[model samples]
Target: MSGASPRGPSVADRGTWPSPGAEAAAHSRRLAGVIGSALDAAGGWLSFADYMQLALYAPGLGYYAAGADKFGEAGDFVTAPEISPLFAEVCAAQIDGVLRALGGGEVLELGPGTGRFAAGALAEFRARGTPITGYSLLEVSPDLRSRQQALLAASDEPPVDARRIPPRWLDSLPAPFRGVLFANEVIDALPCERFVMRGGAAWRLGVGRAAGAARDDMPRFEWRARPADGACTGDAGFVAAMAQRLDDLAAAGVTLPEGCCGEFHPQLAAWVASLADVLEAGLLLFVDYGLPRTQLLHPDRAMGSLRCHHRHHAHGDPFLWPGLQDITAWVDFTALAEAGVAAGLEVAGFTTQAGFLLGGGIEARLAARLAPPTAGEAALGEVARAQLAQGVRRLLLPGEMGEAVKVMALAKDCGAPTAFALQDLRRGL
Candidate 1:
């Protein structure tokens, strides 16, 4: 709901990006054609959410659907899990607490990128002697799923004990479950509806074919906006919903000026509610780059939080190479808390990523790694200790993921986890 910058870069900036290989270029062209057909069917205009869905999830040609290195140095960007095993280790401690409170339960992870978190968390659980009933992963991308499988199966990684439960891959959420549900950087990727304020009303921003504009025989797309108040045949509900959202922001002391642009995940409420339905009793934990609604919707961010990542270069052009880039919008945590309450869950705690890490004992973990080395091990130990310190800094520094990212917990028939006790920012929400 936060507004985007007033003067952001134009789509023309995509020219400075490194070009994809011939095969990747062809893949993008094919995806573009698919999108063009969808636009044609939708009267040459598709809501940004719909376009994002296609670009990221379209069968075999989408960014996530196709074969591409998506995490770590070889990919677009690195996640906390990829940065260090300490992230998952700390998270594992939190999960261990929840499982102990519940007597024992399973762990379900959404979008387990590369299975690094799973591997690390499983190891931590084993080290602590936590009795986990099971470990399940709900991943949509076959490509990433295969990668996860390989990583978890590798002999070099921590082994899943025979007495303990083995990891399972799930196509959908299991019902009547009681355990922990974890998602990292997952909500941000959900398809979101972009809107712009005009004449004190909201207009839906969408994608449309750029007339006569073609690059390498692939059709070009441009931004197009339509009044949300019935300008489009099926936008009546959108108009009402956006109106209520803006009204809520106004009540929270945030206002958007005319021409302000932003995005909101229309399906967020339903998504959270679905998770609530499946999680009969347990914790729903989410860690991502986000903020409370008021801070997120501040007027200064007139252009919104939409971003595209390709080969480590972040930009605003979602139109660049379509399926070849990752597109995401910052999350509105205030909305998440509201959804949890409406779904009959308790807003247990919400805090910055730094607070969560520190509370989960990152300092102790680092100290253990940095313990004085023996005579023969001094050199290797020094190098490892330095790397550990750097990774911890990235996770806890205010300018890094520390302050920008937030961790939120929603509980059902459970007490607030100690992980959030260090610094609860729920009052801001």
Candidate 2:
């Protein structure tokens, strides 16, 4: 329920597999032992948050921190950027509007995987005559950063002048930006805590086992009784459970050897603060796949959106492939909104990709430009026609990325907000 309300299966029944056996089982046991040993060295005891950090952020061995192919057909899954350049084309169109509003500015992007999104956006800007002054990318991995440079080197634009700056990681955002800052699917990378409601209170869920080969690896989803006052029980219950779990771990002197973790990025607020500072007179557009606080705080969303992707198999098993998986969680848009507000950025607009694109003339653009010519005109090849049909379906169909993904924008030091035609979905923020 925390996500877009995945209609495929009941979340309660998802990722509840008892255990794996044989070779896989043996590997799981070894991994658990290794995890415990590591945690013992770190501090003798570990919270679920600390466990997740090691599971996903352990130097050159953690999931994303490792040199694993996490995108495209060769990787665990394919993001829109890897699918084609078209995704960026549409995105660039939106960014153009923001930059123009800000009197023409630059761009700063985060975790631009393989650099395709940034490249495509830059190309679109050049082709559309947006006088972009500079482009900056903040990626952590040295390997991925180099890969991004190599990918962008093939740009068709004349004199591709861009800087691949090292973003202050997990700490602070750069200050005083005057351009359109954006990212695709970047918010999901933030950490989140997992808890289960039990005994009239929420109990923190940790990724560990009782010396039984780590039977449960996913967050044990739970719900607390709705409070009579309807206060935000989400944080209240979560904080309570976390405190109790820390107490228990301390009491037993047990260290989380090896396991996954769930956490929300308090750093998100910090990042937003940096964004507000640098955004002298421009807009910040963040596009990703997630819901708002209302949906996340829904009664049904007792379990959070923390999942792992490996070999195209989506689940909540961060321990399945230590150095060969992509771990992610749903972003708290409400948290993001608060971060923006805290930084003094006025919440200008928010909405889903479906509503935003449609309102911004997707259908109108298609009707005017994508029209089929008369018989007298030329014709596309069979393959071309097939590809076009598929492309149209992908961008317009409701069930696809057309609706599931979302777009949000915040502005500062601007004139009265000029209404852009896009579905605004920030109320939940």
Candidate 3:
């Protein structure tokens, strides 16, 4: 979900994209049936958040729930860790500093896609002699968990010793846990509610059956907008929340023009509270593409940040293939900070990914990789060096993941991580 094509497809370009195979189409149809039933029970209207939740997490049908290759070259998108081991290596440095500060602690990773980061970090930790009590991954997808186990098992660089901690999978957040919890490009995937401002009122954008489409037809879907007031069956208090959000923006000297649309993660507060409830003392780190409220809800971005990806083709249509494509919205860092603070965690640091990497000594890692091979080591070929350099550029350039991806750290009874020392953008939040 990290390295999506910047230029998404338009309505006209949808036809040019590859068509789903028979099996994929049938899978989508089955998921559509599930959604259609839910829609029927909901009186033909379901909030976008509700639809998104089902599309991405519904048991055995949603995107992540089913068995699908969702990472790397063969998947829908490539994440930072997939881009290069440098990302995980630098992240390990930050985690190492925190663990050392706390004497010792574990590392809990949320949505550890493909186990690439876990493998790279474990290797780095072993090399640096970093003391970690354990390494755990909280993956919701059964398919993904199996894949993680397979990859980690086949890894050449296993734990330093048999006694050393090996990665374990978690069913839920461990209560009273003391560790470092981090997620890369995970928050953006959380279901969010889409809203549009019209004539100073907010309307919740949702999904419903297309006009005149028969139930027997290929379950067509369409956008449906309703008042954000409590009148809707499942949208109670939506109006008040929207109003409050807009009022807060107005207080900051920004106002959304009429017809402006955007998304907000409805479960952000509760989600952070859940993390806070579990961690006795640790850091919560989230890295994703987003901006502070002021910029995110600014007038310039009137169209919003909702995006979908299928086979590397980014588009704006979430209705194209339910439970088949990846859907995401840009994170609201300001909201995330507010939630963390409300949940009794201190805002440790906030900065761009580029800043975090540089602060965590990515330069040193790059230098070592570029260094000549040892007498017995294999030579670093010119092509491999160029690829490595290209990957670094993609991770650090302002126009790429560097600026788009923001890193935020929240802590409870822990010190600020060293990764945000280079530049702190907390003021914007």
Candidate 4:
């Protein structure tokens, strides 16, 4: 068996259905048509990457493409920026250094969820007297773009120029552009190719109709492995990367242990290359929950990190609620470093989010925010103090987002920033 081990029943069997009705079923049928058509084109099987692409970006029917809340308490999950202002404040410190080194440039952010991070970071930059040419957001979803615009407009930050780059203009990005680029929780959303190790060889995992399911409108998806001899998988890079990962596992005195499953992101190199191609100079910083290659592909994660988030509940079933929930996989920092270096960018530093925040003065910011007024000054409010403390703990505690999320930076021609200098984990990668 390929590592694409079967877990359990379909979404219907789980009893966690979302918004059931004729309308919802019709929506699924329409979206499934897109996926089914592609499956048909691929000879009744589509690579997991293609399946994921259709499920998340298929015109106006995919999850990200649909109108739905996807952040904070109301959304599937809460990001660091939403958890506290200190995250943006600390991130501002890092961005400030990069901007200062480049003598000021645009701040290009990818998938600016809720625009909360931008609002906070931009406000901090303004407080620090930093010069920002402009703020450009590259978002594909119209619904999300609207939310971001509304959030930014309501922010207390100064009136800074912020615009969304049109899809047509992505290929021909502004030339000679020099600025700091940032992405938060974006890598995990990138489509990954799933693979399983069967008997000593890796097999590509694909999506096809569940066995013996006759219904076309509500076709259940199942993990199916492509045949040997590299036929029908269509992604040579994915196969090669998965094979390399397996070899690495063997080198570490570990075997796939029959039925062990894992994932490989074949598009990471091109993704980094695209960013590096347009970014003429300056630094690129990305924050996400991931690990070094060794731990990411270790036997401990035999089932891989593929996950789905729906109404704050996480499950491994990506086939549930097709265009409603969020689907993501843990990032592999080693792949990121390799891609960045291959694109001619220098690896500045890599470290835990906790280290990055502390080194960037999150604690100082927290203290100043909660400091008592002296000499006939009023003290901070009890309720406000408690809330701030909660956010701090969530952001810095070892078991929380702190150690779970990682901070990595790639510089075009500058040195490592002090934020990451606090604890560089790049050597491990």
**Each prediction's RMSD to truth:** 4.0, 8.9, 2.2, 5.4
| Model 2 TM-score, all chains together | 0.73
Model 1 C-alpha lDDT per residue in residues 1-429, reported as the tens digit of each score: 011111112242455678899999999999999999998998888999999999999989998888898787778777888777899999998998998999988889998989999999888888887868888999999999999999998935454633657889999988678789999999988898898988888899999998786978898999998887565544875786687788889897777999898888888889999999988789999998888877777688798888887766678879889899888888899889999999999999899999999999999988877877667764445666677787888788886678888999999998877979899899998
Candidate 2 lDDT over residue span 264-339, tens digit each: 5545776777777787887777766666654543344444566666555567655554445556777666667777
lDDT of 3: 0.85
The residue-level lDDT of candidate 4 at 356 comes to: 93
Candidate 1: TM-score?
0.94
Write one digit per residue (lDDT tens) for candidate 3, span 99-207: 8888888898999978999998899888888878889999998888999898889999984323577788999987677879989988999999998887777789999
List candidate 1 segments past 4 Å from native.
1-15, 159-162, 231-234, 374-380
Structure candidate 4, residue pairs in collision:
3-196, 3-197
lDDT of 4 by residue, 1-429 (tens): 111111111132235534546765677678877787888888887889898888887888988887777776766667788888888888877888888888887778888878888888777777777767776777877778888888887877643634322111121345557888889988888888888878777878889877776474576788888644656756667657876776776777777667778776778898999899878888889998788888887778888878777656667877765777677877899889999999999999899989999889888889888888787877889987888888877778876777878889988987777888788788888
TM-score ranking, best first? 3, 1, 4, 2
lDDT of 1 at 234: 47
Candidate 3, superposed: residue stretches over 4 Å from native = 1-15, 159-162, 214-216
Clashes of 4: 2
Best by TM-score: 3
- Candidate 2 lDDT score relative to the true structure: 0.58
**Which one wins by TM-score: 1 or 2?**
1
- The whole-model lDDT of each prediction reads 0.84, 0.58, 0.85, 0.76
Q: Residue 415 in candidate 4 has what lDDT?
A: 70
